[model samples]
Target: MSAAQLVLDLALTVRHDGRGGVADDLEDAEGLTAWVAAHTAELAEAAALPDPLAPFTADPAALTAVRDLRRAVRTLFARAVRPAPPSPADAERLLPADEALDRLAAAAARVPVAPRLTWPEPGPAELTYRPAAPAPPVDLLVSGLARAAAAFLASDDRDRLRACHAPRCVRYFLKEHPRQEWCKPSCGNRARVARHQRRHRADAL
Candidate 1:
């Protein structure tokens, strides 16, 4: 997936109220590890890192750090999607993006990158690329996710970012279609149903 999509995917793992609510998937290190394991393929493809499983650091502290970064990214994306300023409480979270990016840059610096030539697809498909030395898995993961966010934030598509407004929803989606408002058909239906219920209540009062 593209960097934007990657970051978006990471930001979307846990629901808006997921930390302590019913949909919280990153509530603990175990859950966070599971989530990382599940996305190994996607993460590997995006980062071009060797050994897809290598990026999942076994350190408990690393797991906690990634979880923290994920939440920080989600907070940034949520703000980007909003039409107005976030509440003062929400505004407090705006600093995460910077911090996460700084951490990623530091982690990335330690990877010791060098340019190398290789033939990717047999005949006549030679290309040069910068390859990095083996480093802690968490570092690569952080760098990849941070790059995704940085790319997305710098792109024009950031304006198209939207958070599902459906009741009890916390998913973020890119506006693929001009008429696309909700993330999925179910959310649209739920939103319509909610509107109808509100109208009915107001009419009967």
Candidate 2:
């Protein structure tokens, strides 16, 4: 894939602003670990590159390094996904990988791109817009991660982010208003109905 497409896919996989909060599905540490494994494989395949260690013959060492970097990213993802006591294995798995991703991100920032117009010019304006260079891969990845983290960290009551409280719905959302609940109202209604039915059954007894 082209560099742009790889960047876009990485953003989608890491941030996951889909109709449903697929990111939240991998809520716990183990889930996060599993998610990284699954997504890394998909990404590598989508890029049409051979295993991270193959297809880049100019520098076999660099290919191995990139593969290790990817592994590190997976480790960070697992840590971010879970909230649990850290074990020795988890610590060992995480630190080097996290450092590698950070370094890789820094290096990726050096790749340049041509600037494009942000908006169409009005008539006779001479198209006087100068585009800025594109951000490095590290910046894109980090920025996307920040957005996703904010969505998860912000509270629903604060009018920032939200998670569907329905038993059957596992989605996260950005609430448009203070009272907003689920990504869709139907999910909220279903949850309410389920709650009501449970209460009524208990009352009948």
Candidate 3:
């Protein structure tokens, strides 16, 4: 797994939670921690790649960097649903998600590549050399994740993405089925019960 793959995996996980409703807070820190832990093996596999440039070692520092980057990504997604007015501290605390994607794109562009070359040879013989394109970098992965988020946020097609209406389950999910709601049926049931209770109380009054 490359850094790019790790980021993409995180993107999918983040999108999974966005199904019910946009999470407005890190209300379930335990859940978040568990999610991160579950992905650790995948992250380790991705971290095995060689360093991006010379003088950079892919060691503990790289692992730490990836973890920090993922954490930042989580925070950005959390903030998107419940944005607070930008304070100086807020700006300093987290990388703006769009900016992070842009940075990733820029980094991806900087990856070295060998251009294809062709040479004419005598008597209709020709020689050519072409370099294989490098695999996508982490930045491109980040950009893709950002695009997915944007699509979910901006699209009017309710069928593509939806927020879980279940109480306290503010997660987003893709609507794979026409009747799907609340990411899981459990949440749906909870929502129905809550609704029923509210209506019952109202009728009593």
Candidate 4:
């Protein structure tokens, strides 16, 4: 995944539970491990994270750090959407904007980065900065997530970020088109059903 996508996906980890409530994918070690496995390859490639000899396992501390970053990310996503409601998972208790920004900045700073020059046999030379030697898997992951969030927020795509408010769904998504409403067809269907139910109840009244 591109860095932009990582931030959005991280914020969306808090989503609709099958039983109609909020569920957090980072609630425990198992869930966090699974989520990282699923997204790690793409993100690692994008961020130049080191490949591990054994599969990466998330520990309690990693879980706390990642969840902390997610809160900040969600808070910023809420701010990006302006007057529109944010995803309901933590809408009522989002971190303060300044705090959220600080969290992201701190996570990204955990790893030291230095600029290096690169030249290809067939390409022109370019100067680029790579993250210095690998940190612990969890630290690198969190730092990468924070960096991705910062990049996304500073890019044009941030303007398209939005919260999905369909029944039982709490997600943030990009606006694909002018008429796009919910995050997907299913959410749109649910929203229509909800609208219909509201109208029917109103008519009976």
Candidate 5:
């Protein structure tokens, strides 16, 4: 997946609390822990973690940190989706996210990485890349997520970021097509059905 999509997806794992006006899954540590575990493989790949560490341990502090980061990301996206220009208050509200991002960036920079040659299907051409050594699980996860979000926001692809329009689907998606509205077909159906029902009610009235 594209970095923009990955960042948006991470923000979305909490779901239901944005424009959708639904329940929050990351309301507590347990929920956050489950989210981390569910997305472990992807997170591992993004962090460039070795296979032996297939699943990262989800501790309480990590859960708290992740949930907090997710909230900041969501807030930033929310502001981006708003019709009006962001006021100073909006910037003030994003203080936590800003601070967290700075810290994560610093932590990521401090981590030591080694350059390694990688081959695709044992081909003649080898790719050289620097990969981080195993570090604190929380640090790795947070830095990776923050960097992804930072890069996405800084890229032109940020223009494609959109919040799902379905009534109860609190998802932010990278709009794949020009005409796509909802994040998925189920959400589109829900929105259409609701619109149809609303039309019926208007007719009855």
Candidate 6:
């Protein structure tokens, strides 16, 4: 997946609970740990991690840090799609744009990495980044997420970023087509049903 996808995935961790409420996928340490493991490849690619498939376990502190980053990411996501309303998850309590940008930048700087040049006999030379200092995997994960989010926000792909306002969904999705509305088919179904209901109620009155 592209780096922008990784950022969208992080923001989407907060989603509808199926019972008509919002839910956090990383609500606890176990959840965070599992989420990290499931998306290791994306994290590694986005963060340029040393080991592409190394296992990662998140602790309570890591969970807290990730949630904080999530807040900043979501807040910026809200701003990226202007004129349109933001996701309902925390629209009223979103951090200021400046604060969110500062937090994201701070998290990304937590682990410094420098590019190293390398070449294989049959391949062109490429630069692979190496961390300048020893840091915990959790720290790398958070910084990687922040960096990916920042990159996405600054990219042209940000134009496709959208907030799915369908019913109970509180997700930020990348619009795949000009005609696309909701994040998924399920959300479209919900929105259509809601529109039908409103018309029916109007007819009843």
TM-score of each model, paired residue for residue = 0.77, 0.34, 0.40, 0.92, 0.70, 0.94
Q: Name every residue pair that clashes in candidate 5.
A: none
| Model 5: residue 65 alpha-carbon error in angstroms | 0.6
How well does candidate 5 score on lDDT at residue 42? 63
Candidate 1 to native Cα RMSD, angstroms = 3.8
Give lDDT per model, in order. 0.66, 0.40, 0.43, 0.84, 0.65, 0.87
lDDT of 5 by residue, 109-192 (tens): 544556677667857765433346666767666766776676777788777777776766757777789998877899899989
Please report the candidate that would top TM-score against the real structure: 6
Residue 114, model 3: Cα distance from true site in angstroms? 9.8
Q: What is the lDDT of residue 93 in candidate 1?
A: 51
Q: What is the lDDT of candidate 5?
A: 0.65
Lowest-scoring 10 consecutive residues by lDDT in candidate 2? 48-57
What local lDDT does model 3 show for residue 148? Answer: 35
lDDT of 2 by residue, 1-205 (tens): 3232333233223332344433432334444344334545433333221233222122333333333443444354344434532222223445564474565555343333233334545534322211134443333323333222222223232233333456445433445776776657887888789999999999999
Locate the minimum summed-lDDT window of 10 residues in model 1: 84-93
Which residues of candidate 6, in runs, are more than 4 Å off?
A: none
Model 3 stretches astray by more than 4 angstroms: 1-159
TM-score of the candidate numbered 2?
A: 0.34
lDDT-wise, the better of 1 and 6 is 6
TM match of model 4 to true structure: 0.92
* Cα misplacement distance, residue 27 of candidate 3 (Å): 12
What is the RMSD of candidate 2? 11.5
Error of 6 at 52 (Å): 7.9
Off by over 4 Å in 1: 16-22, 52-57, 84-131
lDDT of 4 by residue, 7-86 (tens): 88788789888897888888898888898888867666555455671287988998999999989999999999988988
Q: Name the regions of candidate 4 deviating beyond 4 angstroms.
A: 124-128
Model 1: lDDT of residue 119: 61
Look at candidate 4 and give me any clashing residue pairs: none
